[model samples]
Target: MRTQIHSHLQDNQCLELFILEGDASRIRELSHLLNRNIKTVYSKLVSLPHE
Candidate 1:
């Protein structure tokens, strides 16, 4: 799932904002929309490069 999202983000730059912000609410919203677990989303977020 992390790989999938990362690939998607790499393909579309806009998605990077969500990861860059590191906002829990936005993460939760994305998780819900993607039907992915919040923990999984959170884990992916932490793995993102820091600005």
Candidate 2:
């Protein structure tokens, strides 16, 4: 997951770009990227778009 997130971040670089790409459910992608469960990631996210 960390590998995937790093790859994605390296490609996106900007949070807005990452969000616009629609690859995630907001910054929870960070948690998701870290191999976190979807529910936990969602719970940690406040529905705000982030990098």
Candidate 3:
């Protein structure tokens, strides 16, 4: 599943997924949506080392 999802992440790469309400269902639904749209899903990691 991860491989398939990552494959489609090239066109629409999103960089955040905040499940503050702790809803797994939402994530799953989002995953499905992303796949349906062939969009990339991104982890909520909001910082990079200064170059």
Candidates' C-alpha lDDT: 0.45, 0.38, 0.42
- What is the C-alpha lDDT profile of model 1 across 1-51, one tens digit per residue? 233332344443323233335566776676566546432443333445456
Stretches of model 3 off by over 4 angstroms after superposition: 1-21, 38-51
Please name the candidate that would achieve the greatest lDDT relative to the true structure: 1
Clash count per candidate: 0, 0, 1
Q: What order do you get sorting by lDDT, best first?
A: 1, 3, 2
What lDDT tens digits, residue by residue, belong to model 3 across residues 1-51?
Answer: 222221223455434444233345665676567666634433232233334
Model 2 has a clash total of 0
Name the 10 consecutive residues with the lowest summed lDDT in model 1.
11-20
TM-score of 1: 0.30
Report the Cα lDDT for residue 35, model 2.
Answer: 47
Estimate, for each residue in 5-45, the C-alpha lDDT of model 2 and write its tens digit: 22333443422212223445554556466446442222233
Candidate numbers, best TM-score first, in rank order: 3, 1, 2
Clashing pairs in 3: 12-40
